[model samples]
Target: MTAGSVEVVLRRAGAPDALAAADVWLRSFAAALPTVVSPRSGDDVRQYFRDVVVPFRETWVADAGGGGGIVGVMVLRDDELSRLHELSQLYLDPDWRGRGIGDRFVRLAKERGPEGLDLWTFQVNKPAHRFYERHGFVAVEYTDGSGNEEREPDVRYVWRP
Candidate 1:
């Protein structure tokens, strides 16, 4: 796709597209976290997609060209405790990275007019941290490694308009 030629359309996802979205999730996450163990089968991916990704369809699915399928996704929810918009999951297909799909997804979220937004990332994910920082997010908190011994520390970032 040419620079600025890729057309990304944001819309609510339907049940039929859950599997494709899950595929995107699996691929994206595996690429982002190569050391982390991911689901081994399609069934597991589907189940996780149904339980996690499918339910939060309020503002999801960044479809390239309106028909090229879902290239990116951002699952958002309200943080009742902090009264901020929480970005639960944000992923883009490996092939679509750096094509402005990810940036547009953030732009779409900002356009929704949310008062504030928050998200978490692993400490090693410097690229993501930089991306968020560039988009106006600031690191608010950092948590030591959790239950997972292999997992590293997590950093929480917040953005406010």
Candidate 2:
């Protein structure tokens, strides 16, 4: 899809794309949730992308074609044992919001986990809440900031096809 006038492609992320993917996540997190605290340092998040996410998860990136760098990132986790599929992480460059890129990522996540998908977002992120709800995700549970590192009240959303 085209992000404004620039063409954007969604593709599987490899080891080499870890740094750029993490950068998008960091920037998006900072811009979208300024008041929320991140327990991990930038380096730690980058390292996690390199060591665990890219290697273990179904990681995808919205690439601004022709070496324009990653504008968005999405990670999916499928647990066969529990029959659980999670849209673990989804982030986009702050400048790329409202450009249909996040919509594309959510569509991909739904396509990948056609049976169902679950995700968690801070209750304070009302924009995200609306986005997910528009995509047919329902808030199934809520928790008082105790379980997450951010200690922010969060809600779990689930989408089933």
User: CA lDDT, every prediction?
Assistant: 0.77, 0.92
Model 1 agreement with the true structure over 1-161: per-residue lDDT tens digits: 33366667767777766777888888887788876654357688677677766875454887775446788777787788998878877888888888887787788777663798888888878889999999999998998857334456888999999
Candidate 2: deviation at residue 82, Å?
A: 5.3
Q: Which regions of candidate 1 are displaced past 4 Å?
A: 1-6, 39-42, 56-59, 65-67, 147-150
Candidate 1 lDDT score relative to the true structure: 0.77
The 10-residue segment of model 2 with minimum total lDDT is: 78-87
Candidate 2 ranges beyond 4 A from true positions = 80-82
Model 2 lDDT per residue over 47-132, tens place:
99999999999999999977467999999998675476899999999988898988999988988999899999999999999999
Identify the leading candidate in terms of TM-score.
2
The collision pairs in model 1 are none
